[model samples]
Target: MKRIVCLLLFCALSSALPVYSLTFAPAEETAAAVADFERGQQLFHSGSKERALATLRTSVQRDPGHPKANQAYTLIGRIFIEQKRYPDALLYLERIPAVMRSPEADLLRGYCLVQTGDFAGGQAQLLPLLGQSFSVQDTELLLLALTDAAVNLQQPLNALFFIQKALPLAENQASLLERAHRLLQGHLSDIELEEAAFMWQGTAIGQDARLQLARRALGQQQQQKATHLLQMVLASDVTFPYWQEAEMLLQRSSMDSWFNRDSIGVLLPLSGRYASYGELVKRGLELAVREHNRTRLPVRLVYRDTAVEGVSTSQLVSSLTDDAKVMAIVGPLLGAGAEEAATRAQLEMVPLISLSQRAGLPQRGDFVFRDSLTAEQQIQSLVRYAIDTQHISFSVLRPENRLGEEMTRLFVDEVRRFGGEIVDIVSYPEEGTDFRKQIQSLLWEDYVVDIPPKPELPEFDEFGLPIEKKEEDKKEPEELEYPLAPFHALFMPDYAERISVIAPQLKFYGIKDVTLLGINGWNAPELVERAGRFLDQAVFVDGFFSASSQPEVQRFVELYRQAYEEEPTILSAQAFDAANMLLLGMDDATVRNRDDLRQRLAALRGFRGVSGTVGFDAMGEAIKQPYLLGVKRRRIVEIN
Candidate 1:
């Protein structure tokens, strides 16, 4: 009877305690595990992750099924997570038996699963804990983890839901919204977008969704629905982050709004000191419009003189935008005036293809575009040709004025970019007619030969008895001659008037047999007539060559001659191309509004214009392959 009572008491005590009590291990081992677990908890709570991890490992080793071992595994995994050792965290976290998992254990395991790309398993582990009370930081981490998993799973709506919940807890609300917008747009289907808009109604996210939908509808030519959606947002009391954008879209959707798809405004200095240049641009624009109307729907031109005495370019731009309702404007031929027009056009959300070669006109806004061939483009074409012909070493003879200095700087940078070297750079006065000294420096003639030593006299005797100097018959000093500097090419960035004189002088100074590179200013008739023999086989870049044999050039020349009874200049050709770009783009059914036209223009590629093959870069700057011409047989001809 006594033995029976003792056995029953032992069994009762084992059951009353932990499962480890029934294990075959000694009580001392179980006690040590408890001690280690206690110490690890202290270290973990005190933020000594490394020490706590070691102690917890020891605890698990002492007795695998110890009650404290479960908590020990959890703490160890959490420490690994703190160290960003996801694999190690998973190794320990999964060791906890399913029946032994505490909420904290499950959370750590969820993170490990997610970190190791087991997103579905992690989601399953984390979903049930959403309602549990956790720290604010833990809750945010849990929500973000879920968001990531959903995004990777291609569940944008679910990801958006998680993001929306996490917004109030996010430290940078703006950054979070931006991320949401980027992730959600174009990812959600139409129905999903409508659902999302309803889910986030009266909020910036909702307005962004609506705006995106309106844009899609506009792209598909669903103007009536797009207008209603845009108007709904405008009528709302909520202050949208993109309220101005929404209003712009609303105006774009209405046919009566100031965005006529078939009307173009012409802003040029029609009656000023620059009137001749503007007249050329006007003639080109008229020809383009007339030709376009002959084949397609009639496109009207509304001319607004940018040269009115008391009116500013901004006022002119505004009038063209508001009163004329032109889809796009084609000119403001001067740089300063173009900038002013660009600003006002941007403010009014109108597209203006500026003809000015202003350095940063395109940077004014997306609505501002440039169609002129810039100096940079000229230098690029010239240097590319030089490099292609195996001419690596270069010399620059530039004028010492602002335009000259600017062109020289551009040339130097371009040559360097092509892995070519500038051996020497010499400049002459812009207004001075003489380039002899500058050319001499370019040839290194000024520093080539050392001064000849004075003729030595015979040593005088002690009594100065026999020293006598004989006067040789005086001969005119032989003129010093210099070999051309060791350069493969010479770049001259000057006007035709200056080049004509400089070209002949270059030959006079023994600068023959080297390649000559020039800018658009070298394309004049007199340049080839006066200095053609000197500049024979010399390469230069121009924006237009009316004498070319290309079919487009012939057609343009024929039309211009028949219309205006004259040849077309670069200015006229470029203006015609710009006008035709807008006119031809409007013929597409996809271009329903000014904004639509803006996008079409921005994506223009390989548009073969008479000036050259024209396109627009991301910043709305013209991308063109300028005409590369060379003087051959005393005549300017295209270099194929």
Candidate 2:
């Protein structure tokens, strides 16, 4: 049986016939004709429509009087209808003798006639299949024919009636049935469709229907119904597309009722190991708020603790919600915790500006904003500094892992963008202990060729034994080329330890003329100590250029020293900036809403603060240019 099935499959796949063709044979050829017809029917059922048609047509040619011949002809007509070949479809369908014309045949014939633009004839043919006893599929086809004919004649009411009639029969036809219902509703008067849509909005099947109605209402400036429908959608699923719209409507409604005051919330971690950083953020926020208050801006400050280990996240959030009653939130310097708090604030319909640098937070809602620069942004800054300020034009390096690989890619991209070139890119295994071989391959300084030995001379010893003189082989120096000289710079975005190891080796190989550029990861104390002499002429871009003399920066340094008894890092400065911006934007009553705040932030032009002049681009990224810093006398110094 398997062998026979395989043979039949092979034949069906190999043959070509009209998509809906069918064949049958005479009862006199009984067993053979029956087998062929059955095989063809199976192929048709399996979606091999053309092969099934050919096999069935062969059966019909061989035995025209067989009972299956009429069925085969009907099937062939149906296949043509399915394939949307109306002309060819009509030819095959008309051959189904009158006695074999069932409701399905009449439906197919109506469809073909409609396709050929004979609306009246198609309508007349399909009218009989609208009876109660017809199957849903047949009824659906009948209604389709009627709707097509009515639409062609510009009788939208008639088209609507047919669509309504088809809806019940299309219950199992999910997407198609919904589309038909929507079309039917669209044809009715506004009042009528509105009533029907409202009725459907009460049932499970009506959710999507109601959403469509709401969309239409919104489009027509019917705000009340649109708001109601949007609310219903949100109540049903907060993750619905209309949820954001609903939230906006809700906010607008609230504004209309109560626009007297503005509230702001700060989510700094004031009671943990990161408390000092959070306090710095709070100070910036306080300064902005003070300025707002003195200017008589309609704004208020509400603070929340995002303590890492001292309090549960839930309790902290609850305290903010119940005690603070904030309209917007800012701070929470840690990444994961800050993200969680931000998400909660969004869900609660409060705006949140996160101070962390983590990527992949949801940016869809207007309620969440990020103020830190991403790694890619930093890479761009470094690349720009290398090209624009330092005039460095080339790089050579190896990535330690995937992140290293990404850094290499970003560096290369920036180099190309700045009209520079990557002379050599070397990669090594992160776990490998021996980098000598990899370095040798890249530096090409360890090759030697064989030298011929001198002829030996024989001498006689005192014991009369012949003594042969053996000469020591002379060593030849290996040839090495310095590739870094032509290029003005070299980039090494690796761990400080590996960099410390490689830099000295690079200098030993006579590549000391070129400046060595390092990435953010190389800004560490260990690199200076380990690669001291080797790094004498090297220059790298650091996040924090500690020797700046700008008044604002100097004040920041003084304040940070006063508060922490130590100088500030770039991370602390960025945290300060995030806090400052969040609070400054909150000074306006219009910024109570997140979208308004985003616009305000984007419009900021050269707003000077602790971390140089801060502004934002369209993607909510900081736009401050990075400074070029070099290691001198074992200290990081800004290159004016």
Per-prediction TM-score:
0.61, 0.52
Candidate 2: segments with Cα more than 4 A from true spot: 1-264, 268-323, 344-349, 389-399, 417-419, 428-438, 444-488, 495-498, 525-532, 588-595
Top of the candidates by lDDT: 1
Tell me the spans in candidate 1 whose CA falls farther than 4 Å from its real position.
Answer: 1-256, 449-481
lDDT of 2 by residue, 91-201 (tens): 767776555577667778888888778998998888766764766677677787898898777565566567656666776545444434434323344555555556555
What's model 1's lDDT at 496? 92
Candidate 1 lDDT, 1-640, residue by residue in tens: 9999999998886676655435656789889989989998998899888888888899888988776777888888878777666777778887776766887888888877777678898889988988988777778878888887777777888888888888889887776676576554435778988998999997877887887677657545578998989988888887666668678767766754456777899888889799999999999999998998888889999998888888999999878887777888988899878888887776566778999998878876657789999999999898888888899999998888887899989887777655577899888888878778887888787677688956755758699876664567434567766575679999988889999999889888778788888899899999988988998858989999999988998999999999999999999999999998898789999787776787788789989899984789756789999999998888899998
CA shift of 555, model 1, Å: 0.9
Model 2, position 203, has a per-residue lDDT of 41
lDDT value, candidate 1, whole model: 0.82
Winner by TM-score: 1
The TM-score between candidate 2 and the true structure equals 0.52
- What's the lDDT for residue 19 in model 1? 55
